[model samples]
Target: MGKPFTVSRETIVLAPPEAVRGLLDDFHAWRAWSPWEDLDPDMERTYSGPDSGVGARYAWDGNKRAGRGTMELTGVQPHRVDVAVAFEKPFPSRSRVEFVLTPQEGETHVEWFMRGELGLVQQAFALVKPMDELMGPDLERGLANLKAQAETEAGSVA
Candidate 1:
């Protein structure tokens, strides 16, 4: 058994919470900003359930670098969205992901969080690449991309 791990990244987007939430609440919008989307140009994706709310679901399968996983929106609020992710490729694992959006002065404070326990496979993988080392960069890059997307959309509309 491996220890529990949590990874979080935050950024201030020059947009309103609603604007940012629209991008995150809908998995389809992820194509505009999700860092991992570039991993495989041909990644196969499937969307099901409600269009983009609490029951929305997304599944993807691609090359080794892209891996395979399913994400489901479990909850959504004006300031928060929760996702349950199950990965099944290279390795099998599950994690809970959260996006917290807070409106400040005129922008939105977005925090991305993920938590999960490292199973035997991940425990061993940690010996070589700790959770933070493996996931931190991705989380950071994702936030940056999200920030740019939100700001760009907000700008075009203004």
Candidate 2:
């Protein structure tokens, strides 16, 4: 463990808490809005373990942009979902990802966070480009996409 690094971003979705929570619980749901989904058109995906909750998992392998990684839902709740993220290609590292929801009057506030301890290699890389700057834009884009998806899902039923 070198230093703790966290990338956090939030967006308000025009959907109820339950509706938004559904997106976080189901790994496949991510395909609709995950920013990286476009990085590799031929990215291969495997869904395993449980369907869409605590034991749910998602793994993928693709070109350099997509790399290779596996994400497992370690803890889940209506308001929060915790995921264990591991990258095996390009580099190897583990991190904790979380989705937190707070309901507003008619919408839900969703916050996505990734926390990890930067290894020596990462620390060195950070010297050139900080982790937050490198990851922040993607995080922001992901949240925006998530918001759009949630709103669309909510509208479809209305």
Candidate 3:
């Protein structure tokens, strides 16, 4: 046994909290902003449960970079969403995913965070360096993409 490992990352989207929350609540919407989706264009996706909110589950199977995993929405609120993801195939691990939205100057400050206990193999991989370092850039890019899409949508509506 070893200490549990965790990483947290956040970004501000130039849109209202409601708008940002709407985007995050819908699993299918992730394709618009998730950097990982670009890793496997041919990845297979499946969704079950509700269209959004708690009980919603989405699974993906793709190449090594995208891996294979299932994420289920565990909690949802006006400005936040929580999910649990279990990876399979290439590696196995479970992680808790969260999205927190706070209104700031008419824009939404979106913080995406994940935490989980690393299995022996994952722990060994982390020894290479801080996981946050590898994940932060991807998180930033995803947020940036979200911001772009949200702002574009807002502009179109206005």
TM-score of each model, in listed order: 0.96, 0.96, 0.92
lDDT per residue (tens digit) for residues 81-158 in model 2:
899999998799999999999999989989999999889999999999998998989999988888888889899334
The lDDT for every candidate, in the order shown, is: 0.94, 0.90, 0.83
Where does candidate 1 stray beyond 4 Å? 156-158
Which segments of candidate 3 are over 4 A away from where they belong?
A: 156-158
RMSD of each: 1.6, 1.6, 1.9
lDDT of 2 at 55: 90
**lDDT per residue (tens digit) for residues 26-138 in model 3:** 89888898878898889999999999988989999999889999999998998898989899967887888888999988788888887887777767788896668767788
Deviation (Å) of 112 in candidate 2: 0.8
lDDT of 1 at 124: 88
Q: Between the candidate structures 1 and 3, which one is better when assessed by lDDT? A: 1
- Which 10 residues in a row give candidate 1 its minimum summed lDDT? 149-158
lDDT of 1 by residue, 1-158 (tens): 65899999899998999999999999999999998999999999999999899999999999999999999999999999999999998688999999999999989999999999999878888999999899989999999999989999889334
Residue 101, candidate 1: C-alpha displacement in angstroms: 0.7
